[model samples]
Target: MKEYYPPPTPHEHDIEKMSNRITNARIEELEKLKERKDELKEKIKEKKDKMKEIRDAMERGDTADMILSSSAAALNKRGKETSNLTNEDLLEIQEMAIERLEEQFSKVEEELKQLKDMESS
Candidate 1:
């Protein structure tokens, strides 16, 4: 014949303390996530604002004027500056700026989705 042993039970106080600790940890995690989300939102807003500024500058013909007014040495980093900038250069810069902003927006959106999934889990 084999003797049977009873399972050990946790004390009520210990159980309650453990539950509280878990809850507090979860709450802290949520708060940190929310804070990060807010920060990301702010960054997105700033990027959008910059994109708008760039668009507005292009629309007002300010970009061309500014480039034309500045010395080639001042505008070009390579020191092999051309006497005149082509429309293509301006368009390319604008396109690159827009693409960068879009990339940032997408990355933040993905992060937000992951955070939501974590919260649900």
Candidate 2:
């Protein structure tokens, strides 16, 4: 004897359609979240690079121009003569700016962590 399978009832069909819609909506949300996570990671990397560039420029002394360009206002505000600053002094000032950048980077890192947690859930 042959076995026969019955077609789905209307309620069953509706439930399947609703399930697909929920699944698609979830996939879209994850995609958007992944994109935002990628963006935050890039920003954190750029901030790190900027910190390294400042340190490298400070070490060489030759690229004083690069360091000076960013820290000139701070030096001027302190009523100090920019031309007279020792390499060590410039490094110290740059360290302060780096500290500020690090604080901002930490906040971004926390946001990225939150995104990761959300993605996992």
Q: How does each model score on TM-score?
A: 0.50, 0.50
Report the C-alpha lDDT of model 1 over 53-73, residue by residue, as the tens digit.
Answer: 656666776655364554655
Tens-digit lDDT track of model 2 for 55-112: 7876675555546665776777898766666556656665666566567657656665
Q: Least lDDT summed over 10 consecutive residues: which range in candidate 1?
A: 64-73
**Model 1 spans with C-alpha error above 4 angstroms:** 1-10, 64-121
What is the alpha-carbon lDDT for the whole of candidate 2?
A: 0.67
Q: After superposition, how far is residue 51 of candidate 1 from its true place, in Å?
A: 0.3
**Clashing pairs for predicted structure model 2, backbone only:** none
